[model samples]
Target: MKKIYLSFLLFHYCVLLFAQTPPAQTWYQNSDGINTSVKERWNEDENGFKHGKYIRYDIASNQIKDVYFVKEVGNYSHGKKQGEWIGYTCCNYREESSIISYQGNFLNDKKTGIWKEFIQQDFLHGTNIYQEGTYVNNVREGEWKNTMGVMLGDGTVRTYAEASTRKGFKTIYRNGEAINAYDDKGIDLIENDKQENLNKTIETEFNNCYSIENYKNFRAKYPNSDFDSEATIRINKLESEKQKLILAKSEEDEYLNPLLQKWDSMPDTSKTVTFFKDYYKEFPNGYRKDDVKKRTDIIWNYYDEIKSKYEREGEDIGILNAFFQRYPNITTPSLDEWLESKIEKNASVYKSQIESLISKNTDESLKLALSKLDVINRCNRLLHNSYSLIFSIQHSLLNWKLGNTELALKEINIHKNDIVDFSSGKEKYSSVFKKYYKEYKLGYPNEKEVWKQILLIINQ
Candidate 1:
């Protein structure tokens, strides 16, 4: 309970200290600075350049929160510090107690225009000991009030001794030196000014920018910068990755569009014909979209009508295969499996017929093999049933070797090259190859012979 109460007090104290400074955000690296220990704590723009309000804190101190960096913040443009910046002397800052140290305008790294410097009698006591006049380019000019109490810019008059400031004198200044000494209270503070650092920062500028346009802009602005060569290399890498994503999306659409189209044709589809009509009305010149008219139950019923004619006569695999060749894109897994089964059944019946004619060495068995090969090529080849089609190819070739002159060399010529695509090493291709091999086999093809024939066609 004591630890919890102490933590609540510490949280509120730290919040008051950083109220004018950066809130509870994160810190990043600024490797370009002369001092290695100074860290930049700010957000970056698209090009990895430090943008917006920036604070550079000294991590050299061992303390968890350094007292000097409480409110010393400035604006950063193109990763360079610019505009009005406030600097503080060391230790804790409580608004009622902490005095205003030195506030001024910075042009990159150089101090310019009016500035104020403070001397505190006691640290964090909110007391200003002395003052100086206006400055033009790091030098003092005009009249300066030499009072014991410092009249703060926020209409607060404060001194270590309460009523001792009303009886002070004035001093005149030229260049950076004082012409006349007014009193012995405040010492001359003109030579105590620190050097300000500012210039184009994008010019050790990839932690600099995460976007291509920002890197390009950096290159354009600082064409002769040392990082220009590396920026060009990064741009090329980003572009190459972008093109690879485009090609991958195109391949995905090729497989996906048919599934999407077939799915949309169903009556209970989530986005049906009415959805497309609404979309077409919204985007008249939409990509690859054409005018679609409303249709009734005629489409799916008509497909079923065609399917009926082939399967009615005790499942004619040849005519059923021709139906698939005409409408290859529309079928689902159930329909594809059904057709492959029909082909396997037909092939089994014909295999026995061909074996009976082995002694005869006739053209009749050759013609039967050639006809079955045509049916497999038209139907299963679309889905690339490698084992099924490979069996048909090797069987037709063996029958041709038996001296039956019913030549159809086109089956061997076409599929030999095309079947190699199924060996893509994807699980989908591997599953299809295994499925057909288990279901049907006429002339057995070993792994080596199967791959050899598939590749040999490519070279030819």
Candidate 2:
């Protein structure tokens, strides 16, 4: 009985030990169907959580043998990264040393405490790149020093012997905010000292007799300074006083000199109302004030004149182009609104005239009406008018009326092709065009050949 109990106890103990041990997993670094090397090896618990040391290898090929440089070695607990982790980059397995990219501790999968980054100088040497201060919950805390290197391309060379010499800025950050910065010679780059000197210069200028030029010079030199607004206000007041004194002395030209110069530089073709309003404000009683007011009036009247001309003359491409060129700043939608009204009216007139001609059924009258319609269509196209269905149906009807059977068939076919091409993927037919198409199709049943060609083109 004693032997039997002991055997049972030993079996239970073996089972527990086997259950505690994790299963090993191996991964390979393969490229282009070639198994370069063993990339990673680690162990996971029964829960599928990583629970042991993880190892990564950088694979490199050489004539003699395949090299596996240890790239990262770290520990994990229940799939959460924990404890010390070290990472290397730009490494050579055949050499004695490698570039330590980062070395630090991880707590519950978050980086914590100080971390040191290094620039690999050579196979056996590395310079400290930066020293990160302590981190709390992965947020950097306290002072941190980051050193920059002079060499541009990542401080690495193929030979690994001629590495970049460190010559660059050193910035100091406190709690993630850069507090101080300096170059290689240790000159402070935050410019607090320079600002103090600039402030002194501005104070000296202000102490002298009030001069507009001095204030202007100060503003130009230190445009971003805290005193900039104060300098600007002083300059404005002095200039206003000087202008009043010059006007009082009956030298009105002195007051108008700058305004006249600005007006002379204005573009000859088009000027906005706002430009003249500003001129009027600057020189309300000057010699050219009336002229500026007249220019403002002209600009305000220009849009109205163009609108009236467009309304009276119908659609004219030349007039439309001239309106846009003159009022380049004006938006197209306003013009489009006006033009759309005129276009609708023209379309109505054309439709009425075509219908009247079709009812008369006299060839001479029909021919004259067709010629007028053709001219109208040409003008509409030149103006970028969008009445496609009306134009197509007009051409088809005119051809059918003249007994040009093939031309009428071709016109309807073109219209169908356009509809198919335009009505793709979420695009529905235009309501106006759809209505016109239905009317033409139903009204022209006697012209059955043209209708058949249209149906065939649409179906195909």
TM-score of each: 0.26, 0.37
In the range 90-136, model 2's lDDT, one tens digit per residue, is: 44444423356788888999988887666654543444564445666
On the 0 to 100 scale, the lDDT of residue 122 in model 1 is 55
Clashing pairs in 2: none
lDDT of 1 by residue, 243-336 (tens): 8867765755564466457545754423222334444554464433522332323334544665686568565667766565555554445655
- Cα lDDT listed for each candidate: 0.52, 0.59
Residue 158: error of model 2 in Å?
28
Model 2 lDDT, full chain set: 0.59
